[model samples]
Target: MTQNQINQSAWAEKWPAPAKLNLMLRITGQRSDGYHLLQTVFQFIELCDWITFHPVDDGRVSLQKPIPGVPEADDLIIRAAKLLKAETGCEQGVRIEVEKNLPMGGGLGGGSSDAATTLVVLNALWGLQLSMEKLMELGLTLGADVPVFVYGYSSWAEGVGEKLERIDIPEQWFVVIKPNCHVDTKEVFLSKDLTRNSKSIRIADFIAGQHQNDCLGVVRERYQSVKDALVDLSEFSEARLTGTGACVFAQFDSEEAAVSAYRSLQKKWQVYLVKGVNESPLFSKLKSGNIS
Candidate 1:
């Protein structure tokens, strides 16, 4: 169903908003405008926040219920829906129902992914034939990370994460630990100690195991809980902080290894065992739904 053809039956289908991890991030340079240039590898995880749209007779966008501590209008998904409506002048409205499974402030790209999903799915459900490029352009206004999700692929991202080249890496098992704290992304970026300029290396370097996150040091120093989580996760494998994170993860060659680590950590921590993917789950769902 497209546009006016869409009915309440179309609204019954649920859509996925998958989370992403920055496999590696480097601060290549800082722009004169203070926008930090980046060299980052993005990979999606199985974790997702599911969303369902309900038809609203009135031409007003809304959420089923506002997330506590966040106003409905301030929610990224809400903002994304409104953005799409404004861009197309679509008179239709929706009450978005979110099943938020991804932890907030985990540096897992949950919000950006949610926003991207909203943009992509609504464009389809509303029968707005915006080009994927146009949608990605709109997504960038939401966040640097949003474009990657809208692109629906794992990629090597640069230029504050908007520039992307699709790159597929190993889809390994991951044991992720969400530290009992939120690392403020703005604080990490604004810190004087944060690395603003670092030599950028080729994807070959990352493939050959040059996985250094420039913000790791600053984040570790500022959040003791994050530091502790990294230290604990490291015991099982090579631990990495995804973006500026409160969630530290370790990749394992086998699900058994990841399961063992997850089991041990779950006794004392909030953690998840998930698999990595080169493509966003959203794309897979779209394909299966025959809606892409």
Candidate 2:
């Protein structure tokens, strides 16, 4: 599509970056490089941060507005766009505008998803024609969680959360509560008390009702609000942590049940009623817009 055609397309104005949940997270081992070997299941949620990429003639990647408290240089969204340009040597530039709805530090994979969206959409918008495998490879350099979002599927992940095999998980309604505290992932992983020796389990085990998060004990011990939110949410359903979470979530078989729990929880907490999806919303839009 030409630049004028891109600007004329309805979907070009906004792209989605969806939040993800770790249906289960297990630290099976620690790598020599200090990165933990993870066995986790990742599923996308309906909640998303919308991003708009405005074409720029000047070959300069920039954000429309800097995210407060995050330096533009350090923002993952900026870094991802620059990475694409550096790898492809594409002269095309974009001004990124974000509608930041997902909360930071919630273990919801918000930043990683935003970065993945930048990589995927810009690769198309700039006519780079990089394959999905190449995009996933570039995404891994940004963060462990970014590749799955780039892959745009529900996955069974291992090896520091990058090795992915697409999985068909039942889409369920969820009630998520974001606690009034930030759970620093680095701090949680660095703690001497955090679990690092969980035995690896098969996808069969995950499907058969084993959704243990190794970080729960450590995070609960440190963040009282997270612990409290878990307790309150568990009152309605089996609440589980989504990856060293400041947000705890409970899945329901029906949307009605999820909405009921969300209503009760919202009175005292920052809550979201969301639906699990096998496909990332970013790719869904790409398909809808007939963008390959």
Candidate 3:
């Protein structure tokens, strides 16, 4: 069958859009083009926002349920679908339904993961059969973090967070807390007090516990809720902010320890106990032919 005449029901299935945590974020320098040079480690967490696509023969991309306060045009999922359609001259379209469990602006890469899932799922649904490199390139147009989700593995990243090399790390449990606030990443980056220069360290140094987030100081000073979350969580373990701000996390040796910490904080904050994985859940489903 031609693309426009394909059956919609056959392609309908749920796909995972897994959240990520930045194990370490270091600002190595600033680029002349106004982008920050970053050295960071990205690992997937089992926490995810599930997305399902229903093919539409009308050739117009849309969201089945629009997110509050966000216009459909501005939704990254819609943008991703449109970008894929336009780039490949595909006649197929889809209505996306997002079960948004990930918090917005929480430094958990929720939106980027949603966008990456859109690109990956649509590429397959539309039968475009695009190469992995091509999908990663398309994902980069959505956001810096989107490509990592597209790559579908834990990775060490550099160069505005695009250059990636796959790395395997311990599968530890984490207690993630989202404070009652939003952190604007742009504001954090623009802060004059933000650390812009730090000596680059090897992965060995990271394993040796020689890394810290350069944005932590500015985030702590500017966002009191984040500061409070950090201080409170630290009482249980060494809590550190992920990505820019608004969410802080601490690692534990076992699920019981992480759950204990999470239980203590649950009444006061929005918390999650997630297991870190080297491979994304999205890829796991794909490899197993759970979605096609």
Candidate 4:
């Protein structure tokens, strides 16, 4: 069915905000604008944070449960809803309920994914019918990672992560380990010793496994927890940092291998076995008519 044909009532159903992993991250250069020029591969995982929106006639966007330490005014989900409402001049509001599962500050892009899902789902829910390109454009104002989620596909990304080319990648299982501490992205990026001049590589080179997370060395040196987790996980497979991370993941050809790794690691650290996905679960729900 066409987006315009989707009933507004369908907006009431829950939607998914899936997590993403940077299969590889390379820092090519720093722009004059202070944004880092980068090349990265982004792939989604089956794990997700669920969101539900309830229409409110009062025309004031709010959240059912405010995320601790984040004011409603600053919450990305509410901000996304308000942005959409103001952009379209729609006389509708929503009480957003978030079932957050993804870990914050794990480099999993949880908050950005939530913001992207808010933009995508609410456009249809409010009957604004904005195109995907327009939605992604709006998402970029929230965060660099937000556009990828709004694009709803695995992608090869560059130019501070806004430029995207959708790519199909091998579907594999990953053993992900989350350490006990948070790695501040701003701190990692601002470190004096951070690598900012990794040689640029081609997509073909990335597919052949020739790229690495430039932020990993800085992060490991600054955070002992992350260092320990990476050292432990690397014993089983080639564990790598995902974005400026407190979390590291290793890909395996089969679920059984990933599960085996998870089982061994869970005894010493927090771990999960997840499958890589090319398509976002939000799109799957829309196609299956499961949104309502």
Candidate 5:
């Protein structure tokens, strides 16, 4: 049977598109081509959007709400599928089902994770047989953080977020709060006051000392909701913005502590207690053919 034939025989199950937290981001420099050079640690959290793909005859992709306020053509999931099919010469098309749980533009890397999940699962379903590196290369066209999800491991990221080194992060629970406001990453980067000249530090250095997201200042200024969320969550722990804005997170030593914090804020905010994972279980299940 051909690739499409195989996919048509079974109903594709939902795959995980896990959200990520940039524990710390430092802008080292800007590339001549306009990409930012940065260093950061990316941690995979239990918070995710689930996606399932079904084989389709026509070359098309689709989405389900709550939409991220972007056009369908600009949706990263479709862009990712089209890119993979073009690169690998796979004629198969897929109808995507996205159950979006993560907030849009919350700096949680939600959309990028969705795109990367498409690339990884479709590579297998379409029988592309591409290595993770090759898939990651394809993912880069979708976005910077896409590669890390394709890498399927908690990683240290740098250099426009493409360069990745797998790292063992401590297992912990996180209280993530989305203030329901969107902060555009481009605006934050272009702002004059945004820090773009922090000294580059080694991963070990970050592990040992204070590290911060350089985009925090610009994002906070533009979004008062995020600022409020940060201040509110700070009572539990030192609240920090993950990527650019709109979501703030605090780490807890135990699941109970995280859940307790989440429960307290449940009445007012969208709060979640998510555990950090080194490996994505969705990918593992797919690799082992558990979902086929």
Candidate 6:
């Protein structure tokens, strides 16, 4: 079964928010608005976080479990819900349960995806009747990456990651390894040694295999765990950092090949073999009202 299928329940208490990889990232420049100008490809992976929403009568949002360092009230999911409700003037609240599968601060876009999933699911459950564009706008207010999850596709992204162009990425299996550490993204970006001046490159350039994550070098130098994982995964194939990460991945032609590597690394570190997907499974179930 797919990760989404594995994450859902017949008992009615779950939804799926898949993880993402930055196939290629180039920091073209830093915008005056404090956002970095970027060229990157966002690819959806099968590794995901599952969420369940329980509607509450009072206009208050809560989380089932606290995120590591964040309070329930400060959790992005709650913030997303509050923002949506206030914008729509809706008198609804929810208890959001997040089953965390994606590792924290791994540069895998986990929390942002979770927040987006909450927004989308709660919008539907509350009958908010907002267009996807409107939802994306609301999502951007939360975070740049949030809008891409709301759009629900693997894509080419730019401009602090808000601009998106839906693109088809090659279907492959990946052996992703997390070196049991959280690499702070903000630290990577704030480093004076980061390559913020990478030349601009087009989507066609990536299609031709001419782009790479500009943040990789800074991340590797600052985090030994990320460097170690990259080296380990690269022993099997060419491994690449996904965003500014403590996680690194190498693509395989088949699931067996990917899982074979995952098994070997499991004893030594955290590893997963997951398929890459172009479409979000949530779209399928919700679009058809297949909740039953």
Query: Tens digit of lDDT per residue, candidate 1, span 15-103?
Result: 89999989999998999988899999999999999999887889889998889999887899999999999999999989999999999
Each model's lDDT: 0.91, 0.92, 0.90, 0.90, 0.83, 0.82
Which model, 1 or 3, shows the larger TM-score? Answer: 1
Better of 2 and 6 by lDDT: 2
Per-residue C-alpha lDDT of model 2 across residues 9-39, encoded as one tens digit per residue: 6335688999999999999899899999999
By summed lDDT, the worst window of 10 consecutive residues in model 3 runs over 1-10
For model 3, the stretches where C-alpha displacement exceeds 4 angstroms are 1-10
lDDT (0-100) at residue 83 of candidate 3? Answer: 92
Residue range 96-151, candidate 5, lDDT tens digits: 88888888878888889999888888877777888988988888878888899889
Q: 242, model 4: CA deviation in Å?
A: 0.3
The digit string of per-residue lDDT tens for model 6 on 103-169 reads 8878788888988888888777776778889889998988878988989998998888889999998
Residue pairs with backbone atoms closer than 3 Å in model 6 (clashes):
none
lDDT by residue (tens digit), candidate 3, 118-172: 8988887788889889999999988999999999999989999999999888999
Candidate with best lDDT: 2
- What residue runs in model 2 are displaced by over 4 Å at the alpha carbon? 1-11
Q: Write the per-residue lDDT of candidate 4 for residues 92-167, one digit (tens) a residue.
A: 8889899989998899999999999999988887779899999999999999999999999999999999999999
lDDT of 4: 0.90
Give RMSD (Å) of candidate 6 vs. truth.
4.2
